[model samples]
Target: MKTLTLDLSGIYTAVTPQSIQAWEEKSNQYQQQLHAGTGLGNDFLGWINLPCEISEEQLSSIEEAARGLQERCDYVVSIGIGGSYLGARAVIEALTPSFEAYQTKHTAPQVIFAGHNIGEDYLSELVAFLRDKRFGLINISKSGTTTEPAIAFRILKALLEEQVGREEARERIIAVTDKARGALRTLADKEGYKTFIIPDDIGGRFSVLTPVGLLPIAVAGFDIRELVRGAREMKALVDESVPFAENPSALYAAARNSLYQAGKKIEILGNFHPRLHYIGEWWKQLYGESEGKDHKGIFNASVDFSADLHSMGQWIQEGERSIFETIVSIAEPNTTLRIESDEANLDGLNYLAGKRVDEVNKMAELGVRVAHIDGGVPNIRIVLPKLDAYYIGQLFYFFEKAVGISGYMLEVNPFNQPGVEAYKKNMFALLEKPGFEAETEAIKARLK
Candidate 1:
């Protein structure tokens, strides 16, 4: 791991050592309570080590499923909310070019996400486009009872039945929910849909590596074994004995919050690797949900360095003093296609010479580093050696542990998202159920 120590001078680098120590102590105590009978312990974070929990194996199956869906369908609809869809969407969108493309190495996977929101126009348009077309649905919800995905699944299943006439629709759907059983589990078995589990020990946001994440990523044609390998490596290497002050993950968690205490109310994460943009989304959920409480702490945001250099980059270079940036920098590209000399010079007269992209990238990074330093900005860099399965796995595990420790340091339950459930309750009340209309009208009156 290439560790970049961010200079915290002039910015508040102070932390309560006693508080940090207390968090560590609490984390140690909760390790078993968290994992309980799973036998995975905190070292593996929320991952279960059983053969049934073979993340890599399931991912391969997911890929095969994805290919099957792709061949038979015109579109793939993802149904889930919160961490379920965000992490996956963030990854897919981050890797893909912002402007839609007509060409790629692979047949593009057109992924349409629903159930995250119940927008009438949004769901309505999707339904119209998908009308009588060949499409498949992948729904990720720990409980089949969640209103959003549940509703979307009901609608899509009805459509599937109409298209395939009930018999074939059963095989066209996949469900990723709880391991033992939940509403989703029951539906999967009853409806004859292929199912995957979001490991029981893992909470929603932390359930990324499990089926919650793998199913989507695998469907998008990402290499899942490499992903599992990356995570597994982190499980093997990181230990509590690694000095707290020097432990990369712990140090990262502590320092950012330390700045928060000093009145730096915004933390920006910058990623150099376009592929890992979703990891930034993963980070936002971790930091924001864990720290955004009791009228306290910084807001987290992410930027892709070179691409955003033209837009948000302007403000960041001369932005408000509220942000302390964490640059998730990558040292190498995943694939290097050499830039050939422009023989035709259709766009411009060639000032270009024989040059590897790495050379140009190094120069750009140097320029960004200097500008950031000059602006009196507090920035730390997380240098990933390369973009691959192993490194991403390491980054995921490292960040997950950091979030847990950071939550501990902040005295927040990072593993829980009670606040997220609040809105769902309100939505449930509004939806027409047997006894909902009266209470819903009461709540709606308050809004008025």
Candidate 2:
């Protein structure tokens, strides 16, 4: 099986080969810190070996539960915020057909998401849509009190029970939360809902290999075992023992940091493949949350190429010189499509009629890289042999490992997200939640 490959050649003009090698010793040291559990946020290092550590029994159980959900529900709503839903959604969107949501029938339940947002009309429409469809809920949260998911779960849980009775609702709902405690876990136990435990050692953003992501990807009918196999293979390839020159993760970490040092502050993840859009979202969270700390880290951003080329293209082309780009290049699309020859030639596209559509897209990809590089932006390319569960799995682990190394290179704790709570505190205070009375008073006085 061919693995994902990284090319830092385009970035050579900005980040030299010698510079990358110079960081090798430091990268290796960071790798040692990760392996030795001696670094900051080491407690969350469970994800470092998660792919290899996943047991066959766990895979079997996830598959069995997924099978049960498929047998019953036509639509399964995966409810969670941030890492809870992003990883699974990214994988599911990448693997499933782009038009699966519009399909009248499917091999497995069409997985949907909620609790990630709190839009009034969005929740209203979701509830109304599920009114006639057979649906199941996968409620994911370590603490059941996260406002968004909690509110979503409350409304959806009531609807599920009222629609299918409490007994059946109990069977349909699955809780992925803390094992021994947490509001969700306590309720799951009391209601006898089938459950999966999110590992205490693994943070939410890094929990994709766990039931947090696996169950939804499985419920969508993708191969979880193959995904894990690919990730495991990548895990071996990027281990501490791998030489810096040969290791993609270490090289990527080094190269990006070198670009950062060269005054390039923004890293844009550009992809030609539309299906990989959510993959960009997941990547932003992974890198942004991990490294964007201490006021020091590359700003993570993304663009869907050829499309965004018209919108954000001008800024990227003529704007600040502090930007760099990383492109996800797919060697082969899953389906073959050829541009048809039109006799009228009105659109003036007949000259390239014999080529596959992917060929044109590949040209656009190449063209953009050249244009962007020429326009003073450094470029890095990641080539995937193809898009599938296995390759996507490899990509996941590849980025995860790279972020770990990159975050350490930036001297930040990759695992902890202390800044995320600032908004939550203000929101709670403004809403006058019971526990935040003092905060509510303080905030109100300030408001007045």
Candidate 3:
């Protein structure tokens, strides 16, 4: 099978081969730390070997649980924030038919998301819509007390129970949370919801290959096995023994870091494919939370091409030179649609007739890269053979590995996200949640 490849030819204008190679020793040292479990946030390194560590029994269990949900419900709501929901959502959206939302039937439950936000109208409409549909819930959390997903689960669990009764609802709900503790695990044990463990060693953002991501992608009717195979392929290639020159993860880590050292502070993940919008979202969370610490990580952002070409395009082209782009370029599109000739040629696109839409899009991508490179933005192109469960699997693992190497090279722990709690503290204080009396008083004083 063909694996993903990295093209750094466009980046030499900003950083040379020697510059990137300079980090090889340091990058490999951190890579060894990751393998030896001696790095910062080592407790969460379960994900480092996760693609290989996954057992056949676990795969069967995840698939069986997915089948159970698919057989029972028309829709499955995956509830969680950050890594919990993003990984599954990214893979599902990438593989699912773009028009599946308009389809009347599907092979598996149409997976939707909740608990990632606290928007009133979003949940209201979701509840009202599911009132008549046979829907299930996948409540994902380590502690079932994280405010967003907790509130969503509370409302949705009530709805499901009212629709099907608590006993039957238990059959429909799956809780992916702590193995033996936390509120979600306790409720799952008491209520008898089929459960999967979010291994204590793996953090939420990196938990995609685990039950947290696989179950939902499986429930969405994609091949979890192929996904795992792709990830395994990447896992082998990124092993510490692989030389840095031939390793995609190490090369990516080195190149991006070289660019960072050259004063490019923001890393924009741009994709030409529309379905990849969520992939960018997933990438942002993965890199942002993993590396955005100690005030030294790259500011991660994402853009959808051709569309963002109209809005964010201008700024990216002529804006500050502090930005570099990593474009996820798909070599072959999964489907094909040709542009037929118009009789009048009114739009002057006749020259493009007989061309596949993807061909045009690829040109737009190449054109943008040329323009951006000329405009002082360095570009890194990650060419995927095609966008399938397998290659998407490869991409996920590739990014996960690169971020770890990149984070360690920057001398920060990639596994933990300490900065995420700042907002949660303030939000809890303003709401006057118990156990936060001091915070509440301090926040109230500041507000006054």
Q: Quantify all predictions' global Cα lDDT against the true fold.
A: 0.68, 0.94, 0.93
Weakest lDDT window of 10 consecutive positions for candidate 3 = 103-112
Ranking by lDDT: 2, 3, 1
Model 2's lDDT to the true fold?
A: 0.94
Writing each residue's lDDT as its tens digit, candidate 3 over 298-362 gives: 99999998899999999999999999999999999888899999999999999999999999998
Q: Give residue 208's error in model 1 in angstroms.
A: 1.6
Model 3 TM-score is: 0.99
- Candidate 1 lDDT, 315-335, residue by residue in tens: 888987677777776776655
The TM-scores of all predictions, comma-separated, are 0.81, 0.99, 0.99
Worst 10 residues of 1 by lDDT: 3-12
Task: Kindly give the stretch of ten consecutive residues in candidate 2 with the minimal lDDT sum.
Answer: 97-106
How many residue pairs in model 3 have overlapping backbones?
0
Structure candidate 2, residue pairs in collision: none
